[model samples]
Target: MKKSIQLNQDNLEQIGNHIPVPNYNRTSETADIVHIGVGGFHRSHLAYYVHLLKNSGEASSLCGIGLREGDQNLHDIFKKQDHLYTLMVKHPDGKIEPEIIGSIIDFKMGTTDPEAVISQMAHKNTRIVSLTITEGGYNFNPTTGEFNFDNPDIQHELRHPNDPKTVYGFLTAALKRRRDAGLPAFTIMSCDNIEHNGDMARKMLLAFAETQNPDLAKWIAKEVTFPNSMVDRITPVTTPADIDILAQNSGVQDAWPVTCEPFIQWVVEDKFSNGRPAFEKVGVQFVPDVGPYEKMKLRLLNAGHSVMGILGAIHGHPTINACVEDELFAKYLGAFLDEEATPILGPIIGIDLEDYKDSLLERFANPNIKDSVSRICSESSAKLPKFLIPTIQENLATGGCIKFATLVLAAWCYYSDKQADQNGEPLEIIDAMQDELHKAATATSSDPLAFIRQESLFGELAENERFATTYTDMIQELYKTSEVKKLMRSLL
Candidate 1:
């Protein structure tokens, strides 16, 4: 017989002895809003907050939509368990607390039934359509944050509008349907890690709409609202251990489980088109402006990760905790944040750099959360501009030191080459620039300065004499040292 779908109260009470459960409710009624990209981060952060609001009898209109196709296992599990799953939050102090979240009422595979996605988007009751689609899904140019219209997906969608091919196409078709039916435009809230996420979404949507209907694009610009947001949480890829723990604690088998660190934050702009749920009651900060918050996160938190990911991975550290525990890695991370990142971020308001740095260290040292260097280092081309280059440019503009920033660039160049270490083991090079980087590394060039002058990669930075000279010096140092850890120690 199949196991019953019920939580063991005895087991819950036993675990309760270890971690105190906050008096937050965890039951939500049917949902009215729909969320795209139901990944680990969404499940741990947004879904948990929505569940709390539901349990507290505050918001009853929030549903989720999972986008991946051919994933019947996840759909079946949610169906059998009444759309409920336990989110295990692992605290930095090694405490685990499991709470049943029930805000998701349904799931639809967009690739399987595209019409169904369009139909749901046309629904008048669906007031907000939030997206957690990662940076790559946006079909944006890394150098220019604009939509890539020449992409095959966008081209296909343009040729065959009836059968939508991309997310942007589906959104435009759905909006067209709403326009014909006289439904109000839903607010488009982006919770991705990209800088100015709201603005990016708006720009892409408008660009897609303008291809066929300029009037529609204008109307959307005026009618729809895209609120900028800064979201923070260390949600690692789920492992087999997480599955076993969840099944043992919750008495329900979840096919797609998520585990995350205890730290969570969501800062959103206070703007909406049709209507919005009362998310403020569940700890979402609705501020008049989110620029300062966005800058703080994009620079300090994300930039710090970029600095540690390359250096730590070179030292053969797998997880963030492993890197933080190493004395050298810890000190390098501190210097990068304090001396390099913070100096450029001094102009941003509403940010306590010291407190934020402390919180970041604690989050990184969370042993229970297994964040991987490979995951953080992926898509460096898209991430570097948003996280690192802006700080570099700011420092240069203000006559600040660019030594550490140059070292970071040099480390990124070395990481992208996909070389082997002293042990002859292959190193993982995670980035979209893999092919280009390989070509650059293997080119017949003996001078490090010539290598730094690659226009395709550095753009205007290669033309700047001071920046190029510094980058050349770092590249030479890296080649001579041949050890990322040693180079980092010397710089610190």
Candidate 2:
């Protein structure tokens, strides 16, 4: 048996044939970017891009600042492996391409020491402070489209500004120091999946800053530039199985290997205060306005994922690949896009609508990727509004077909029942609003609007006669039988 290569800075040369190893001298590189959340998607996406830039000998490197205590796993793995990890992109044809990314030179866990993370952000070399802290991390109320000031973390940060606990706290404090010291502000870039994410980040950061110091908020509004971006890549949470795949296939044992589809895209606005890396060289699109692209991606791809994820979970599909394998589910997804979502969509520059839809189906069905249904299913409360609700709202405005989108919500209500699948295995309800959703879903026996009536989740859409009727009907049909193919067919 061939010996498994232990992944570390020293082992790069030994595994060059099996995986593309970075030839850049990582030790000499300084941190040009400080990414807030050091998770799988960031590893396979942004950091990977920086790795490409670093390999070109651009001297641009990264420092990962972790927020969640759960991120300690990343800190431990990167620390032990000399900040090296494997990125294995799987193709539909069963070919796996592995690359050892060496872009991240250091990591600081904020849960342990906020001061260190703040210092890294305030550094002169840190030209960009990026974030992938998930959708919920922004601490904004999804319904109101404003910062949730009542959040304990935001409150804590406001009270103890210097020794901060949240992203806002760390950002505001760091920027304040830089401002006071007369250093140029680093670009506040958000790589998350929110529409107008740059604006959202700026708003929340300034809101938090205002609570601490209004002067600081004013300075940030004037000095810092938060560039909106549309980032696309189906990066699943890495499983233990992925680690084993790396060890057996690539002759490398990576503790926290990031696996993703070969397709990756980033469309970023060119508005940056400080300088940025030459990300454009690595296929990152510098767009005039990311609005159209963001909508295209969020509605079609992300919203499509939620529909499949919820219904797939109820159908006992383990992964997205399995969901697309079912012809009925694929047809449902296509119909959802073409009939319900496409009419609401504006023109996407240089993208064919049909080709993009087909590509989404192909990407979802890549058998090797093993993207989990539950991973996409989690946080439906936040995702539905961001991804799907716009379609519903627009359809209502334009008088288009909304049956498909309504059914997607109904599927969510059914899936949120907190019960087992047909196999009698317990279905995990993983939402911030789990208890309320579960209660509402389970209480559909009394009032079908129990879940939909949640003002934060559905807003006034539940009151619409057309949507209300369709949603109620979906709930009734879901209760009668687990099969939804016929129901989906009826919409078409």
Candidate 3:
């Protein structure tokens, strides 16, 4: 029996008893943290944590700010429900735990009204400006690992500081106001998946700020704090069917409900300019340094995804679970984690590497999540550098086993060049540097080093005989044989 209850502040109490709703007073809450790039991950991870804290009567709320024109859809969906949405955690055995999260008190889009968004960021009550912008959003040079100051958006920001478009622009404008008004600058926490995310955010933001206003940039540098955080949880892209399923199973009609796997982890550095919620009481780990934990997640979990994503894509696997369900694929991924990725990492204080690796395999194999392989495969140009390249660099420097890592890189070359599986099925290819990658990969016969020679992404890896030799060999074998599984078996 499906009950009909549209999700909103007015109807939170009306939602069926099966679904958990916020018990606190929503009317009195104001924005404490202004989050940029609001989407599924934000809802499930940060918002989910805030919802938990608020359940304990914590005085903190999230004000989501969407910066892009594409974010208008966010306005359409979140505004309808008074920024209320259901988070449905899909367990491995097909059970769901639905909770109505009320941590987000307001949502604003810079696309509609930039002034409102800037004002919200500059407000006295807004003590933190956090972000979940994806890896490429930083606008940093992937090779040199520096903030790209010449980016048109940065230039546009310098030219017209008042009318801002990019996140950097908005932050610069708002920070200027705060400085001029003599209000203390807020903490700039980055919950994105990048390693040392807070540090990277600080570097990139400061670089942009330096270009426009050197004096204000110095003030921001002196006063502001950026906390690096390692956030984890697999929240797949929400589907139309997800909405319907939530309605059917939980009887909560949320237009853009979030669905994710059961597990979640947040490790934040204990550094903030303004005060932060007592998040540690609600399962958030606040440590002195988030470096070890972040490196483990990035090199193991994120890198593991790329190992399977590229190989599974070329073999025509539709979803991550389906791909891992294949015995050969599973074996190859496990060996890559055990033999290649795990070797370079230093031991963390509390974590067991073996347990973490096993858990990742189980997480990827969760049938209920149906995590998309193509979704994992998206933006490999950005992902590979952050995830896999570190392992490669570390191995090459230490003279460790580069076999599995090299093969994965070669597999990516094939995936990029063909843009289709062996059976001629078209793959869903999405990458920022696709044109350059495709061009370099297709020219492998004449210039075996062409792909890795792209200094922006690969740096000098192409010059290294050991890596280039294996990459060239495996790439040739892939094009010649096209038996992706057999290739894996041979490597194993």
Q: For candidate 3, write residues 339-387 as lDDT tens digits.
A: 8788888979899999999999999999999988788989999999999
The local distance difference test score of each candidate is 0.74, 0.88, 0.89
For each candidate in turn, the TM-score is 0.90, 0.98, 0.98
Point out the higher-scoring one by lDDT: 2 or 3.
3
RMSD, candidate 1, Å: 3.8
Structure candidate 2, residue pairs in collision: none
TM-score of 1: 0.90
Better of 1 and 3 by lDDT: 3
TM-score, structure 3 vs. true: 0.98
Q: After superposition, how far is residue 31 of candidate 1 from its true place, in Å?
A: 3.3
In order, how many clashes per candidate? Answer: 4, 0, 0
